[model samples]
Target: MVGVMRSCLRSLLKLMNSIIGMVGTGMILYSLWMIRLWHQHLDGGGSISQIPWFIYTFLGLGISLCLITCSGHIAAETANGHCLSCYMVFVFLVVLLEAAVTADVFLNRNWEEDFPEDPTGRFEEFKKFVRSNFEMCKWIGSLIVAAQALSILLAMILRALGPDRGGYYDSDDDYTPARLPLLKPPVQQPPYAVDSHFKLKNDVWNTNR
Candidate 1:
């Protein structure tokens, strides 16, 4: 029963990591697309000299998340606790960082109003550009943040309450006897000790190991 539970737990963890991987990859691809869109906006005489910091932030976050999730997935497959410990620490830090960034994107007024007004209806074009590029990223970033938080929670639970058994489970067939070296007298040493000086004098039995 314990083994069955452990198997289920591992499967669940893998599923969660797979979700993380997918989301992270999606964010990365979207960021790249948004970057291209921003470049186009720049070429069209848009006065937003700076792209939103959140674009680069999302890229960094997505890469880190994908790598960390992959590492955690592989580590969870092992019985070693150290890997899980390290992974948990990373997950905790990332969760904090992601939450903070997500909050900043909304709460900070500077980002939304950074662009300058153009007199020849360019402002309207830029507004559409911002809405299209920023809105998708904003929503996706929010989702990714929530998903990362969820990942952290699930990872913590898995780390704390692992397999139903205390440790790894193994069958009787997996057990093997330990091999110990057997000590024997050196082959070159004769069974009886001989006195070289007095050729006839010799010990009854040799004691050298």
Candidate 2:
């Protein structure tokens, strides 16, 4: 019954990892889109008035998350303890990075401060237009962070309650209580020797009678 439950848990964690992997891939694409837009709209006259570094950072986080998802699924399927441990650690870092990015994106929403040179009064218009997009991206980061946190939890749990392992080939042939060992057949006495001994004893008993 415990094995059955562990199997079910492995299935569920793999499914979640696959779904979150897709989400992480989408986030990477979104970060690329953000970079493109920042260049096309915010960069002008040899001055790039945008936060591209943060977007790049977010992209790295997304890639790490994707790797964790894929590796975690493989580890769960194989019941690999070391692989699972590494996955959990990397995912925890991803969660932290994503949470920081989300907080920075949502809290620091002052578009005018980011691009302070607005002579034609387009900053207000830009703010109104870009705020929604910013929020969307921020929510994406937040969601991924949440998912990664859950992935960490799942990985940790799997490390504890995963499955039976440690089976390996044995060279010796001693029986132990820890596990059943292969046994060899005992040596047999010759049938002729046994019959002669029994006949000699019978003749001695008959002569005495």
Candidate 3:
């Protein structure tokens, strides 16, 4: 029953990681598509410098997220302490960043002033979208934050559980005999040593004669 629960938790973690991977892949592909469109618009008349820096930021973020999710997958599969610890650290940092951004958005009235103006206008569009569907966005944002928290919790539980039983030994085999040390043969004593008293009496008699 415990094993079943652990397996379920591992599967859930993998599913979460897959979801994160898809999100990262989508971001990367979108950023690349935007870059391609921008290049076409330039038509050999403009340099790459004309491209918005936020696009590159998204690309970087996407790559980082993909790498982190890959680590998460490995951690879930192997249940290694080190891998899980590293995954948790990276995920915790990402969660922390998201939390900070959310806090700023809620607490600061001049938050928009802190961000650079988007040359692509996508940022403005995103803000408009969020405003239009604030409740949906709020629920989505909350779910994402909750998923990250749950992933961290699951990873901690897995790390505490250590590696799987199947990894070390077979369940059906009784390995006690195999693990036992080989027995050494008993030592044989020389005949003279066994009859030491007789030899000593003979020596005494010889000395007396």
Steric clashes per prediction: 0, 0, 0
Model 3 lDDT per residue over 1-209, tens place: 76777788899999888777877898899889877866675796755444487778888888988998899999998888999999999999999998898899999999999888667666777689899999998887787677788889999998888878875766555775655555644576766544789889999999999
With candidate 2 superimposed using the best TM-score fit, by how many Å does residue 119's alpha carbon deviate from the native?
A: 19
Clashing pairs in 1: none
lDDT value, residue 65 of candidate 2:
67
Across 1-209, the per-residue lDDT of candidate 1 in tens digits comes to 65565566667667767777887898799778867877787798877744466667668878987998888787668624666677777878877876675566578867546533433343455458767899786776676566556656656666766534535446444443322223444357678886675553333234331
lDDT of 2 by residue, 1-209 (tens): 66676687688778768767887797699778767766666456445544445567658867976887889888878767788898887777666665675567568976336533543333455457667688885676466566666667777777787555423435334335335433645577777555788889999999999
Please give the CA lDDT of all the candidate structures: 0.66, 0.68, 0.84
The numbered model that scores best in lDDT is 3
Candidate 2's TM-score reads 0.57
- By TM-score, how accurate is candidate 3? 0.78
Error of 1 at 43 (Å): 7.4
- Worst lDDT run of 10 residues, candidate 3, spans 177-186
Report the Cα RMSD per candidate. Answer: 8.7, 7.5, 5.7
The residue ranges of model 3 lying beyond 4 angstroms of the native Cα positions read 44-51, 172-174, 182-209
For residue 70, give model 1's deviation from the true position in Å.
1.1
Pairs that collide, model 2: none
